[model samples]
Target: MQKKSLDAVLERLMTVFAVDSDSELARKLDVNRQTLGSWRSRQSIPYALCVNISEAEGVSLDWLLAGEGEMLRGGSISPTSKPAANPQEDAILALFRSLEETDRREIQSAAEEKKRIRDIEQRLEDLTEALAVARRPA
Candidate 1:
């Protein structure tokens, strides 16, 4: 597999966290400035750090790592004071937001179809157990 560019990932991290400098980015990542510099120099970032940033900042790992799909897991942009550099991304976000409620639901359902099927199966199992209890005499 091709390795991702750390500089690009770091740039996105700065934008997503609204940090103006590498020092600020390090602080946001909860690491020392020197360590952040080392990662930049090595062109690699730790997976644990990525997971931490994703969970803490509500960012999508896919977008942060590969610049694919929406930035946030819920497709909501971070509430940053600075505007994102990409206007096309902003426009796409606007179009997605303008979609009707049912349309949004359909999109979410399609995105999470596997999870929905697992949930349905769990419900079926619970109902089956309930029916079995109902059929038994006290």
Candidate 2:
């Protein structure tokens, strides 16, 4: 199958979002900064990564990859609640929700590693508290 060219996708995304740098796009996509750099320089991105960014950012994949239509698939609609600082982030999250099992596993692995680090930090805090308690006057 013919893979979609990365430069085309990047250009469309840049135009749609009014962004100048891959870093900003990556931040919007919630992918590691380096990943965006790789996409920009190498002109390749994983399908999951593309989907991740597209969904999180609330971009239509058709527009993002092919430059076929409007930046917003549907026209502007008033948000009911305080909007996410980055509506695209909400799109990325929604994109993540639609991923396949294998793709989800990869994303989950990334998230789990971050969660594990947080858990370890919490445990360390608990230990520090216990040490403080032990040192308190009887």
Candidate 3:
């Protein structure tokens, strides 16, 4: 199998996250350090992982995966420094940041639950199509 090229994307991630090494990047991405090394070795990053990172970090999916357009989505601020344009949004973000670790985990869990539901819905659609094809009068 050919190793996929991800040098540009990885470089951009390191720069954007202000990380010096892949281990640091892995920590920021909430992945095991070995997983980062494995990705580097395989030269492939999972699309779902990319999506999760994009959503969690407020980064643009296109920018994260293909390095196109701006690093962040419209109206989304970078976690490091950029402030939200709306004062209310800034205040909400500040409150979120001030939450305890357990509260933060709960919020993350809710987001993950939404992602799980979407995945399940897609899987159901796929299965329904397969079932229809299986029952076709051929």
**For this target, which candidate reaches the highest lDDT against the unseen true structure?**
1
Q: Provide the TM-score for each candidate, comma-separated.
A: 0.52, 0.40, 0.48
**Would you list the clashing residue pairs of candidate 3?**
none
User: With candidate 1 superimposed using the best TM-score fit, by how many Å does residue 64's alpha carbon deviate from the native?
Assistant: 0.7
TM-score of 2: 0.40
Model 1 lDDT-worst window of ten? 100-109
User: Which is superior by lDDT, 1 or 3?
Assistant: 1
**Judged by TM-score, which candidate is best?**
1
Cα lDDT, model 3, residue 13:
68
lDDT of 2 by residue, 1-138 (tens): 123567667655554444556777677666788877766666676777557667777777776766556555554556865465787888887897577434644665567779999999999999999999999999
**Candidate 3 structure, TM-score to reference:** 0.48
lDDT per residue (tens digit) for residues 1-138 in model 1: 133567778877876765667898899878899998888677788978788888888889998888688868887546785575798978876887788534554555465777879999999999999999999999
Runs of candidate 2 with Cα error greater than 4 angstroms are 1-4, 75-138
Ranked by TM-score, top first: 1, 3, 2
Better of 1 and 3 by TM-score: 1
Report the Cα lDDT for residue 116, model 3.
Answer: 90
Question: What C-alpha lDDT values do all the predictions have?
Answer: 0.77, 0.67, 0.74
